[model samples]
Target: MAQRSVRASLARAFLYLVLLSLLSTGIAILTLASSLRDAEAVNIAGSLRMQSYRLGYDLQGDRARLNEHLTQYNQSLRSEALLNPGRFWVPKEVRERYNAINDAWADMEHHIRQGDIAWYHDNIAGYVAQIDLFVLALQHYAERKMMQVVATSVVGFIAIFTLVFFTLRRFRHQVVAPLNKLMLASKSIERGKFAHPPLDTDLPNEIGLLARTFTRMADELQRLYRSLEDKVQQKTLSLQEANRTLEVLYSCSQALNVGTIDRHCFTQILQLVRQQEKVDYIEMLVGENWLLCEGTQQESVPWQSAAITQQDDELGQLRWQASVGSPPMPLMQSVASMLGRGLYFNQAQKHYQQLLLMQERATIARELHDSLAQVLSYLRIQLTLLKRAVPEENEPAQRIIGDFSQALNDAYRQLRELLATFRLTLQQADLPAALQEMIAPLRQQTDTTILLDCRMPTQALDAQQQVHLLQIIREAVLNAIKHAGAQEISITCTTSSTGEHTAAILDNGKGIASLSEPEGHYGLNIMHERAAQLGGRLTISRPAEGGTLIAITFRSSSSDNNDEK
Candidate 1:
């Protein structure tokens, strides 16, 4: 059978107790009834012996009452309640002694009735001895039966007590022990300790099942609590990251809104990110130039980086080194985007200003052409007339006149060149087209062969960069033709793998051996100034192959190199 529950077990224990009590009481009652019956039989036997004595006493006392005593004795012997010893739980020896007493009484009655006093007297001692023996037998039987009842009662009590004791022990171990464990486990749960003790399945009872259920509940709670905690922590981190990103964007917006976006402003932004990111180092760059740099990397791992860019202008990249799990990539991206917009705005303003300046230059060029060209032309004509009017015999005055004329011619040429430079504009959005236009007039003016070699990205330079770059090339080409008397000039424009550009003007000419010039020699100075405006490094030198090479190397003011590591 399946093991009982605690309730059933208790019920069973009570039932066992009740049954034991009933069995013990029954044995006691049976023992008591048997003792009572034995006692009654003993009493009956005493009465019979007393009656025999009374009959003898009556005959000795008075012969007139002899028949009455005999009659009483006879009636007592015939009474079944006194003589029927077999009806009680009497011993066989008791019944046999009673029967012998009955026979002796009958014999004594006959002697008394026949008037044999001496014979009756001689047999009366044996008859009384028989009655006494019968009485002793009945007493012995009652005492023995009573003793048996006591021994049975004692044995039953011991057995019942032993059964109840073991039953209670089973309740303590199986029911009480398991219940106590469950209570302790519940207390632990209340205190937020979800780990539980092992269930004792060895006991196949309801308490064992309860323990197993509680253990499962605790394990489930631990799992759910851990899961909930993890989710909450993850959400907290996400919120923290979002708040940090918002803070960065707010600062960037403030800078942009206040029009304070400059090198110092960007440096403050880098420090701000450094404060939040907890990194070993932080640096920002536009191509290779660092705008902001802070801290130092004492570790071997490389910094993670993100590009700062707008629609086309790549402002720079932001780089930082942090430990594992502490990355501010989203914040960095926001910073990049905000800074990129600021830089784009700055570039747009510059472009707008350059356009305005170009318009003014063009207007000035037109004015110079209208006023200065006419005056220089008239002066050249007058000098020619004065030279021709001078007499050939006055050689010294003729030579002076010729020198004056020559000087006027040179001034006119320089003025024309300046006007052409000012009038120059990009008719097409390409470097080659602008170069072709700048050198087209030169080809007609000089006997030089101009070779144009151009390799560039499709979306070349901005308007301001294009203007400065073209001016530098034009100055170099003019220097090669007019100053060096070069016969062959080649213009090359190309981009490097890093997206940096180089524009070179080469000439097969009598190379100038001197890099230094006297004061107010404006040719090289003008070219150098133009290169500076383009943010290009300019170099002019006699190549080993016997030619002057003027080269300007610079990167676009926009995009970063895609292959930058």
Candidate 2:
């Protein structure tokens, strides 16, 4: 391809050179032919002038001689007539001479009368002078013509030669030379050198076009090579990072297998994470309820269900609450979720574990109530009977009975409280009725005045959301009574314009600590967590007027809450 291109270029150059040479030669030849023709015409006029001058001079001499002979003939006739009458022979001689003279005169008169000789002699003289002038002009013209021919021939030769030389030289330098360089560069590129060659800059014609083409090709190749290199490097780095992550996952799985089901296992998991990956806080929760374990009390630590399922029914989630150098929240959730998928398929197992735990606690509470409480009651009765039977003098028996009765009463009370705690674990009841039930208990138990300032909407909440909202309100009210030292508490439930359900609990007492404390304020955190689990939010704020307000909000879907009639 390169050779063909080069040959084609050379051929074009040759054609151009030939055309230029032909044009130069043609112009020179035309000028020379015109000069030569002018020189011939000048030479012919000079010859004609010289001949006419000689002919005029000859005619004038002939006319002068003829006039002299006529005068001599007239003298001879007068001598013959005056001398003698008897000399006939002399007269005849004279007549014969006269006849010759007459013939001569007749010839001269005929010549003069014809006017050809006179005109010829007069014009010849004029032509002779004209010839002299013409000779001078012809000499000058010949000199100029010779000079012009020489000058034109020299200039024409030089111009043609110069045109031919430069044309051929340019053809070689422009078309052939650069094309040769380009071909060599192409061959080198084909052989894998990939080095760019210098382009010819001397020619501003077609060769310049070829050089630019080559330069563009080189630039494109360089760009493609660099792009491919970048892509390969990026892919390699990505694969390396992926491999490292997989290794970490494998190690985590091994550690899980070795650890136990207690708090120690949770600590071990946290330690492994801390040592392996730089993290801000790590927490391991046990059982379905995410029961807090010792050494995992950092407020910043995120509490998420473990990724691995503890039991067949319970799923485990591991979350990173914060990282020393990483961005917060949703990012952490994404990372934890990705890692968690390897351990647990879904959160259903976690709910199952929670239910099982609830069942177990209930069973234990029932056993304690049936057996331990009855025993304590029997003991108290025996102590009362013995105290009555003993005499007033039996002080020792009285004291022993009194001590025994007190001990039995304490045990009975403890059992009753445990039973109440267990009973509270029942599923959520109706909203208004459940709220009324909770308020009655509060009124009976504490001196604090509790008021329900609720404008219940015609709509109701979903079963799950209602349960969560009630739990959050219960926790808030209890916390207010215990911590805030509130004398009066107001609970209000309302619906928002967008069909959202809102419940607000207001306490007129010292506000709780800021919500920043994660573990210390368990009640608020639990409330927030429950709200979030039900797709709701809990906001706790203290007003400048010296009261703490806790509000819970949730969405009321048709399945969850009845629409307003």
Error of 2 at 542 (Å): 0.4
Q: Write the per-residue lDDT of candidate 2 for residues 414-508, one digit (tens) a residue.
A: 57755654455532233566577657776787899898865544124434455566667777787788779988999998765455778999999
Specify the poorest-scoring 10-residue window by lDDT in model 1: 556-565
Off by over 4 Å in 1: 1-240, 257-262, 288-292, 312-316, 384-400, 424-473, 481-508, 513-522, 525-544, 549-565
List ranges where model 2 is wrong by over 4 Å: 1-422, 425-429, 518-521, 558-565
lDDT of 2 at 477: 84
Candidate 2 colliding pairs, count: 13
lDDT of 1 by residue, 1-565 (tens): 2376777878888888788778877877886775655555566666766776666666667778878777777776656544475666556897788678777777787877777767867877778787778778867776776787788788878988898889879888988887888888899888888766766755777887777778888888877987898799999999987887788678767766754344555656766777766777877766442345667775786778888898866767877887755566777787888767766665455455456757877999989988988998888888778877888899999988887777777777777778777877554444566578777888998988999987754233566677788788888888788777888999988777676888899998999767865343556777778878877789979998887999999876544354212
